[model samples]
Target: MDLASEEDKEITIGAFNGWDESYAAAYNTKYALEQDGFTVAVESFDAGPAFTAVSQGDIDFIMDGWLPVTHEDYIQQFGDDMEAQGCWYIDAKNTIAVNEDSPAQSMADLADMADEYGSTIYGIEAGAGLTRMMQDNMIPTYGLEDWDFKISSTPAMLAQLASSTDAGENIVVTLWRPHWAYDAFPVRDLEDPEGAMGAGEVVYNFSYAGFTEDHPQVSQLLKNLVISDEDLASMENIMFSDDHYGGEDPDGAVAEWVEENDSFVSDWKAGALAG
Candidate 1:
């Protein structure tokens, strides 16, 4: 009889970097997989590339698919080639946040007073699903053609938010819920009356076909995974904190978080095995 291949004990996980919760979840899941005597390889890419990687069988799966709005097209595109293991987080919000004191309280307001924000809307990675929706749907739907959409990385946008908010100046940027930025800065999400940027979505664990049958235990654990907004934000904040990991070594940070929440981690793994 042939011995089991070493590849059977290994799993590759793809993740996107611009979003903190994506990294946090990917790292957390990686740790859990390691505990089960499996080697997990995590590769980071922009949202578009990440989806392409999974669909093309370049990576086993990714844990950051926001659905019903943000990544709906991706799901339609990939079709039966990929499948969702489970939904772990709900109402995954996309936002246009501004300083709490800013005059603009809604997307409509932003269209009128673009000068207050320097005629530019700070944005995250251009390949992000959120960025795409904003460009293709929101901008045209809301008549926001005048505002310059500054497509950049998340950190750069956060830096601009920090600089402007610190000086009591107004700034608006594309942001998301369950992110550390909500805790680190005094900002509020703008109202989108037109629902152009999509509505509340759920974050999902998506994998290539037959991933579950090949790696049942690991797949089950991910499918049984459930996380709340408070706990998620706390974990993400730890990963983002300078005093925690200093923005480096996400695995170390995840290990620390796992240790602190031993009961939660224990329950997660045990529940998976039991079910």
Candidate 2:
């Protein structure tokens, strides 16, 4: 396939709302696509609607899907109209994290230390799969039925996390790996001895039906994409940092990341075009 001869060069990428990894991947992929002389637009939606839009061909692809567990319901509903482009990131896991110095080290310990941690478990959107797992599995299994499971937006939860941690107060909040928080905050995941949180999952790129056939080069790019934890973290750290978050130059951040990983970018582009 000649990159310059592609007919469908304009693309729409979907991302989940308030998901750092989602936007990080979307913008990064946007940068790559733009570099290849393709026009890209990224739109954000909650998980459910994002899946629906992609299945209906409203968007071309999304890069922040967690497989085998987190996003299982959406997949079951829309899998027939979507293509799994393969995992770009492995070791993805939903977690309930607490301050690093907190005495409670596991979900089992949260029940007893409820008062110390304010008898609350902060969480992201109520509809999120992470929230569902906590409500249905982790909370009950760990005897935290009476505890406050506060449902709110991811930013709100993170704000609370920031305030609590800054005060040296104990706090617990729902979080996930492949996230910038682990690097920016003084927090750690609580052990789930009973496996209520499920095993680690892989992050996949999904496209609408026939997306591959429509844009073979982009499909090849998706297939060839694989980001290491270290690189992803670095990019996200820059992306979500105070200077870049909601800043005027969002693309500049991605450009900076790309400049830093020029060799990887070159190899990735070459591999995709070679197909």
Candidate 3:
């Protein structure tokens, strides 16, 4: 039985993308939820497929719902059919990461470095909110019609980023904060001249309709959950380092960290148990 069905049942939780940090974090949360008397089965899918699954009630929830803007279109399409469980992180921002070797320190710099950058701006998942925002807004706002913006899946885009960054070549790609990539890479967000990408973001936990009634306890846990930037940064730091703080698995390390930091964990989970 899925966590949602068990008397102390295991719930099937899933992520939007396989490579996202949320996959590891979900396992950490799963461990804590189990310790609190629940079971969890975690899984992952690319953005489009994940939305379809969640909308069709195939998955319980996704913790990486970047919102009220970035994933706005997805939510609009799926909102009536899904329940937004809670907000997890606030004041998030999307970034434009460029190779450290590039002389481009800002969006304007990219204009001059276009030749060096191969006249391209790489982005993740063509239909993704960020990519669409860049295509429909940022490019036009900044007059980047001449530049080719490449759209590939998250892993492919990041893999290319890693390769380009490693080679100290000039490359620009969509990036975001409160994500491991920000910590792992020596990159900077290109300065935006038009501000079309916006400046703030928040992470939300979302589920399909009727989920609250089906899994009241888990819903309560999710509704009561909130984490600060500092807490998230610390968690991200630990999971990204050594390939293993609790072993080779980032999820295991996060689980151990949460267990050890009872006080902090309590702030996010224990509250649900209280009221």
Clashes of each: 0, 0, 5
What lDDT, from 0 to 1, does candidate 3 have? 0.72
Q: Write model 1 residue lDDT over 192-269, tens digit each, in one string.
A: 998977778889999988887776767777877888766687788788865467568988888888888887677786
By the TM-score metric, which is better: model 2 or model 3? 2
Model 1 misplaced stretches (Cα beyond 4 Å): 1-8, 46-58, 69-74, 100-105, 108-153, 168-170, 241-247, 270-275
lDDT of 3 by residue, 13-47 (tens): 77755434576557666776776567578877877
For candidate 1, the lDDT comes to 0.82
Native-to-model Cα distance after best TM-score fit, residue 98 in candidate 1, in Å: 2.6
In model 3, pairs of residues that clash are 2-10, 3-9, 3-10, 3-11, 6-9
lDDT value, candidate 2, whole model = 0.85
Ranking by TM-score: 2, 1, 3
Cα RMSDs, all models: 5.2, 3.8, 5.6
